[model samples]
Every structure is written in structure tokens, then in C-alpha cells.
Target chain A: SLSTSAASESDADELQKEQQARSVLRENFLRCLLSAASKNVQFNMYEKVKMEAKFGACDIDVLNFQVSDLHTPIGVQKEALIRSQDVISFTFEI
Target chain B: MEGGWPLLGPLQWVRYVKKQVKVKVGRNEEVRGWLFTVDPVSASMVLVDFMESEGTLVQVVMGHAVEEVQVLKEPDRKIADRLQSMFLPPRTSILDP
Candidate 1:
């Protein structure tokens, strides 16, 4: 019984770690992709991200943001896409 | 900021996106490209494998367009299709901001 309890605790901890890792991965992935997508701009990288996904059917989101003329900042307000069991996400602030 | 491809009407948007959106394009950027199935309301830009007609996809945002449109004509459609499958099993890595 003690061994079973210890194993359960370990499993719980492992699950928590996995969830946190996934969250971190999401944050890191967005930052890199957005940094590259926005390129050189004054895009204030907001920490809030709206995300969604699915295993089938492709979802698309399009927008026209007027950030600036000379320094056009490609600010991705929010994005989510899922098709073919994969996901495409984006997030930024204007 | 830079202007976006208004895509004009939905029909026009469809027609232009049938192929692949031209990348590195800027204002007045007019190149035939495929509109990704990003969302119900918005459209994402991507390159579809011509052979499979359903495979690997590279989501190229409109903002990625810089100045001169860079259109690559010779990507092995077969390989492109196979490689695109790697992007499937949708999972939101980044929460939308």
C-alpha cells in the first residue's frame, strides 16, 4: 500500500511537470515565431495569448492591422488554427 | 505599420489563394498564393503540396512579406506533401494573445 501511494504521488508529479512543460513550450514557440514574424518593429510583446486547436478541419484567421506607415509593426492580436491533427497558433498586441 | 492584403472580396481571396501566397511581398504585393484554412473568419497564408493536394504546410503570415515577392517555383510537390504531414495532430502550443 505504501509503495502504491508513493507511485501515485510520483505519477501526479510527473503529470504536473508535463503540463508545465507544455505551457512553457507554447510560450517559447510563440515568442520565437512572432519575433521572426514581426521582424524589426516596436511590437510590445504582450504576455496574454488566446489559443485554440483541434484534430481535424483547418481554421483560418485574417486581419488588417494599421500599426504604422514607416515602422509597420506586424502585431498579431490573436490566432489559432487546427487542421489534419496539427495546430498553428499566434499571439501579439497592437 | 504595413498594410495587409485586403483580399478584396471572398471570391477574390479564394482565387488568389488557390496556389500559394507569395512571400516577402510588400504593399501592392500581387502574387498567386494559397490561403491557409486558419479560421472560419480569417485566412492564413501557406504553400500546399501540388502533388498530394493535402500535406505539409508552412504558415507564412502576411506580415512576412517584406518588399520584393519571393516565389519559389520548384519545390518537389511530392516531398512537400509528405513533409507537410509533420504539422498535423493540431495542438495549441501558444495561447492566442
Candidate 2:
């Protein structure tokens, strides 16, 4: 019983360390998104498709990106939501 | 690297921070930059590329799209400082008053 309790204590310690790491990483990522707001961002998508749009905001789930003036091959859309699954990467200048 | 990237928990992903990484994404695109942070929720990586002239480029590679990640270099003291301060607000003087 003593060994089992010690093991559980260590597990709790590990979990706490992981939570700390997650919070730090998440905070920095949120700052990155904040800095990217209103800048022109280039999105690289599947099938070698590339598009540019003014950066807006990303949902908390990170599933969708709300953008403006999305430049497509055909024409520009005044506003749009780009599915995160369709995008490989996106870049913006700071 | 590929399938397990998004599943790599924050504890694992944080190990890559403050280093230089080369990420392979999509078909043939490879992005090289200083590793900043990886979003714990999505596992997306925020990379910073410092240009010669001015300004920095920030690239975010979705976790699902990453094929491979390679560690190129570790950050020096100066680079680590820069990376940490990239998104920080300008410091205000508290002693002025």
C-alpha cells in the first residue's frame, strides 16, 4: 500500500509538470495569434493550393480561421472562414 | 513526426522550444525557423524567422499537416532572449514617476 501511494504521488507530480508546460505553450501561442491579427497572411493548403488573406481570428478549437478579403484564383471574397483542415501552414510578418 | 505529431502532449512538445527546427509539411515544403511555441490544444507550431534587413516572419504549421520535424540547432543566449521577447509588449517605465 505504501508503494502504491508513492506511485500515485509521483503521477500527480508528473501531471502538474505537464499542466505547467501546457499553460506556458498555450499562452505563447495566443500571443502569436494576437500579433498576427490584421496582417496579411499566406496560407499553404492541401493539393499545393496557396491563398492570401488578411488575418483575423481563430476559433478556440483551432478548427476555423476567420479571415477577410480572401484572395482566391477566381476573385476576392469579402469575408470567409477557412477550415483549418485545409491548411498546411500560414505565415505572417511581425 | 507524422501521425503522432498532434498527439504529442504538451510535455513532449515543449522539449522542442528554444531550438531551431526544420519542419516538413504538405507535399514538398520544408520550413526552417527558430522554434517558438507549439499550441497545446492543436499542436500547431509557431516558428520565427529573422530576416537580414528587418522584421521577422512567423509561420504556423498545422499539426495534422506536419510530416517530419528535425532539430537543426539549439538557440544561443541571444536567440533565446529574442524568441522570448518577440511577442512581448514594449516595456513601460515604472520608475519615471
Candidate 3:
């Protein structure tokens, strides 16, 4: 029982450390997202699909990206919601 | 999202912050920049590449798409300070005499 308690205590400590790291990292990321607002961003998606749009916002869960003036090969869309699952990466100048 | 890089925990992810890294994404994409931060929730990485006379370019590589990550260089004290201050609100000190 002593060894079990010790293990549990260490697990708790590890969890706390992980949570602290997560919070700090998430805070900086949120700030980066905020700074990227209104900037021209290029989104690289699957299937070799690439498009440029004005950076708008990403949901808290990062499930989707809300962009403005999305430029597609066919035509330009005034607004668009891109599912995060389809995106490989995105770039913007700050 | 379910495998590969996503399996890495916060501690491992935090180790890459503030270091210059080269990230391999998808099949044919390679990105390099100063590792700013990684979103623990989505595992996305925020990278900043400073361009001469132009501006800073920020790239966010989705966690699910990361195939590999290589630490290229470590930031010096000055570069670290710059990276940390990039998005921070300017500090206004109050003098207490």
C-alpha cells in the first residue's frame, strides 16, 4: 500500500506539471492567433488545395477556421469556414 | 489526430518551444522557423520566421499533419527575449521612490 500511495502522489504531481505547461503554451498560442487577426493568410490543405484569405478566427476547439475573401481556383468567396481536418498548415505575415 | 505526433504529451511538446525547428508536414511539406509555442489542445505549432526588411511570418502546422520535427538551432538570449516579447503587451513600469 505504501508503494501504491507513493506512485499515486507522483502521478498527481506529473499531472499538475502537465497542466501548467498546457496552460502556458495555450496562452501564447491564443495571443499568436489574436495577432494574426485581419492579416492575409494562406491555407495549405489536403489534395494539393491551396487558398489565400484574410485571417479571421479559429474556434476554441480549433475545429474550423473562419476566413474572409477566400480565393479559390474557381472563384472568390466572400466568406468561408474551413474544417481543420482538411488543413495541413497555414501561414501569415505579422 | 489519433496517432503519430498527437501521442506526445505536454512535457514533450513544451521542450520544443523557443527553439528553432524544422517541421515536416504531410507528404511534401517542410517548414522552418523559431518555435514559438504549441497549442496543447489541438497540438498545432506556432512558428515565426523573421524575414530581412520585410516582416515576421507566422506559420501554424496542424498537429495531425506533423510527420517529423527537427531542432535546428537554439535561440540566444537576445533572440529568446525578442521571441517572448513579440506578442506581449508593452510593459509599463511604475516607479516607486
Candidate 4:
């Protein structure tokens, strides 16, 4: 019984540690996103496509980015939603 | 790295924070910067690159596009402090009476 209780205690400890790490990571990430708002961002997409847009907000799920003045090859879109799946990476100056 | 990257979970991802990393994205692109944070939900990585000029560059690599991540170097105290305060709001200073 003592051994079983100790095991359970360790499991709870591990869970708590994991939760703390998750929260820290998430908070920093959210802050990063907040700082990125309104900055000019360059997006690297699939098929060697590179474009720039005014950084907007991203959905909670990180599925879509709401951008403005999206520069496509043909022309610029005043407003656009770029799916996260189509993007490889993006950069912005801070 | 590879398919297991997104599944590395929070604990594993946290280990990479404050370290300089070289991340391989897509087929051939590589990015190098200080590891800021990794979104647990989406597994996206935020990297900060200090430039010669005053401003810094921030790069966000989507989770699904990551091919490999290599730890290049660990941060010293100064760098760690810089990374911690990079996105933080400026704190008010206390006045001496």
C-alpha cells in the first residue's frame, strides 16, 4: 500500500511539472504573437512561395492567420486569411 | 525532429528553451536562432535572432514543417536574461526617497 501511494504521488508530481511547463511555453508564445501584431511579416509557404503581409491575429487553434495587405505574386490582397497548414515559416522584425 | 517532433510534448520542448538551435524546415531551408518558446498546442517554435542593428528578428516555424532541430549552443546568463525580457513589458522603476 505504501509503495502504491508513493507511485501515485510521483505521478501527480510529474503531471504538475508538465502542466507548469505547458503554461510557461504557452504564455511566452502568446506574448510573442502579441508583439508581432501590426508588424510587417514575411511568410514562407509551400512550393517556394514567399510573400509579405502586415501581421494580424492568429486564431486560438493556430489554424489560420488573419492578415492585411497580403502580397501575392500577382497582386496584393487588402485582407486575407492564410491557412497555417500552407505556411512553413514566417519572420518579423522586433 | 521528423514525425515525432509534434509529439515531443511540453517537458521535452521546454528543455530546448534558452538554447541556440539550428532548425531544418521543409526540404532544404535552415534557420538558426535562440529558442524562445514552443507552442504546446500547435508545436510551433518561436526563435529570436539578435541583429547587429538595434532591432531583433523573430521567426516562427510551423510545427508541421519542421524536419529536424539541432541544438547548437546553450545560452549564458546574459543571453538568458535577454531572452526572458525580450517580450516582457517594461517594468516601472522604483524611485529612491
- Per-model TM-score versus the true fold: 0.27, 0.93, 0.90, 0.95
Give the CAPRI class of candidate 2: high
lDDT by residue (B1-97, candidate 1, tens digit) is 1234333323333333333445444334343433332221233344333334542333434323323333344335654343333333335323322
**DockQ scores for all predicted structures:** 0.04, 0.92, 0.85, 0.95
Q: Which candidate number maximizes DockQ?
A: 4
List candidate 3 stretches off by more than 4 Å: A1-6, B1-3, B91-97
Question: Distance (Å) between predicted and true CA of A80, model 2?
Answer: 1.1
**Candidate 2 on A1-94: residue-level lDDT in tens?**
9999999999999999999999999999998998989999999989878899999999988999999999987899999999999999999998
Provide the lDDT at B81 for model 3: 74
Question: Any residue pairs clashing in model 4, and if so which?
Answer: none
lDDT, ranked from best to worst: 4, 2, 3, 1
Error of 1 at A49 (Å): 16
Q: What lDDT tens digits, residue by residue, belong to model 2 across residues B1-97?
A: 5558888898889889989999988788899999899999888999999999999999999988888888999999989878878787666222222
Off by over 4 Å in 4: B92-97
Against the true structure, candidate 3 reaches a TM-score of: 0.90
- Per-residue lDDT for A7-80 in model 1, tens only? 99999997776555445333332332333343222221123222322111122223332222222134333332
Candidate 3 i-RMS (Å)? 0.8
lDDT of 2 at A36: 88
Report the C-alpha displacement of residue A32, candidate 3, in angstroms.
Answer: 1.1
Over the stretch A1-94, how does candidate 3's per-residue lDDT look in tens digits? 9999999999999999999999999999998888888999999999999999998999999999999999987889999999999999999987
DockQ for candidate 2, please give it: 0.92
What TM-score does the A-chain of candidate 3 achieve?
0.89
* Pairs that clash in candidate 3: none
